[model samples]
Target: MPFIVHVLGFATFAQGTSEFMLSGLLPALAADLDVSLSEAGLLVSAFAVGMVIGAPLLTLATLGLPRRAALVGFQAVFVAGHAAAALVPHFGFLLAMRAVTGMAYAGFWALASVTAVSLVSADRRGKAMSVVVAGLSLSMILGVPAGTLLAQHADWRAAFWAVAATTALSATAVLLALPAGRDTTAARPGLRTELRSLAVPRLWRAYATTALTISATSAVFSYLGALLEDVTGIPERLVPVVLGLYGAGALAGLIVGGRTGDRAPFGVLLTGMGTVAVVAAALAPTAEIPAVVIPLVVLLAAGGFATNPAVNARVFGILGETRTLGGAMNIAAFNVGIAVAPWVSGLAIDAGPGPAGIGWVGAAFALAALANTLLDRHLTHRHRRTTSRSAPTAVDGARATTVSLYAGHDRPL
Candidate 1:
């Protein structure tokens, strides 16, 4: 509801554009850098590696600083990284720049969600988080395509230049609009206390759920182009249209999920994961039918992403005082899924059933995540019952908090 929250959302939009724009420019980048396609592909991996490492590390390092300052600083570095990436003559230098860019993005990514939610009340946390998260889905639907068009119409370097400019603009906006405030009180915990906060098994369950859910979604999407052409008999030209529909579905899902998540965290997550598994399994049998498969693709995106806000809110609710570390860890888990899912699916494709079978692989992952979600619920309930029998500390109260999606209501959220 705050103007600053929207500013943070804009920052996320800029960051998400940079994160996904590279996917569309790899071919042009490969040609310009005089490298093979596979080599150019490594840049994506490089970014993921940086995100996984930078998220928690940078989040922790910045804990004592003002939230507004950290945000502006991160975006400034992100802009510089893209600008450097655009000017680098060699592929290695560009790769290094992208890694740095990823680190900057991770810092902003972790903090922005927290900053957004911090401005809202407990009942509205999911909605606030959703505003920030929607920037990512919007990037997939809009920014990536625009970047691809820029690369095709101009040079790939032009795309990077545009990204850098956009990031700089976002940084300026954040600097001008975001208020300077420490995210926490004067008694900031030491690094050891922060590390101890992450030791909660319930938090790890949330992390695992995030990782596995992302892995499922990424596995299917990473090979979607191939699946569309090779298996669905759709021409290559229409793939973007189909993918665009998928993006729209994701945005819609995110909106609905955010609203539902505020009401029923675990229920929404379970339902979303179950939908993903069902859609993925159905895709395995229905890939040959474009009409059926196309809708399924949209459903897949919707189902997979609907869990984002809920899972994020759950982590925030459970972490309580440790929210910063918890948020960073969750972001890292997302990147872990992004990095791991495609690799696992690639292995599956290379081993046997070809590209179409990626659906089954994705389905298996969704099912596994569904199982994990069940475990998380069971643990939450068990912890709640245990804590009620004895005096509970702050951390124990947080751990025992009910994160159930439906709570007690059988009616829809």
Candidate 2:
């Protein structure tokens, strides 16, 4: 409940706006740069690529830096990237700057995710995560739309200029607010030790689940406009209204997940993924019915995103002591989903089923995520029983230790 945590969210909101604003400006950007739509589309992929690479790379690069310095420095780079992007006359330069902005966003997110926890008690980690994560959802609901309006009313470069200015303001706020402190003392373990911690099978399982859970919605979301137009037969003017409905569902899910995830991580995961699986599979069948498909899409967003906080909290709990690499790796996994989901869905559409195919593809991903969650629980219980076999009394102690783990008894939550 510290002020710094909310400040962290404020900073996230600014960066998130920059991250998603590009989608709305693509047409204008393409025309202005004298490029094709597909060529301009590469900017989104460029950002995703940078995020996937930068999460761990920058975490290692700034391994021992203080939290405040790292955050402010990252924001400075993000601002510079956006500013440079706005000023550049050529498409290549803009693409490179977008990638640079993504890298800065990734590094900032990697540090800030754990930093939010450093200021809170174990019991409140979920609340902290919720506050931090809510910024991204809010950006989709609010900032992206505003940026799109700006681009329509002015120019695409104006949107980029606005991003740079807001990012600079948030960086200034972060510099003024976040106290100076080591990013992570536990990370004092050298690079080799930190890297080795990531080899754990359990961690990779968590990473896989994170990627799958995220991909569930991201795939469908990428093709939503097309599906709404070609399949649902919705008018172009009403598309934003439907998108707003989806964003509302996403924000609502994030809030619910953040509030309940700490006490019932598995339950949250199951319910959320189950909802996504159901809605995703139903989307194609219901596409011809607006009333049916619209609500389903909203539920799809809600269900897919509800698992986010829980999965993130689980990763933090599992790697409580050696979190140096976990946060970065989890972040990398998120970008992996973001970058790959749309591509996979696009392929499915191109292959045969058309826009409706995105539904089945998304459902497959959601079901896989659900299966992974179940497997994670089974493996955890089995591991606990195996570890408790030393002595009868050790069983109680081991159970308590795991209970503590779930309660975030360890510091790196």
Give me the candidate number with maximum TM-score. Answer: 2
Q: After superposition, how far is residue 283 of candidate 2 from its true place, in Å?
A: 2.2
Residue-by-residue lDDT tens digits, candidate 1, 68-148: 788889888888888877777589998888788888898998888777776788778888988898888887787776776
Tell me how far candidate 1 lies from the true structure as C-alpha RMSD in angstroms: 4.0
**Residue 167 lDDT in model 1?**
81
TM-score of each: 0.87, 0.89
Candidate-wise lDDT, in order: 0.78, 0.78
Q: After best superposition, candidate 1 residue 313: deviation in angstroms?
A: 1.1
**lDDT by residue (tens digit), candidate 2, 109-178:** 9888888866677667777888888887777677766776676678888888887888888888887776
Show how many residue pairs clash in every candidate, following the order shown.
4, 0
* Error of model 1, residue 315, in angstroms: 0.6
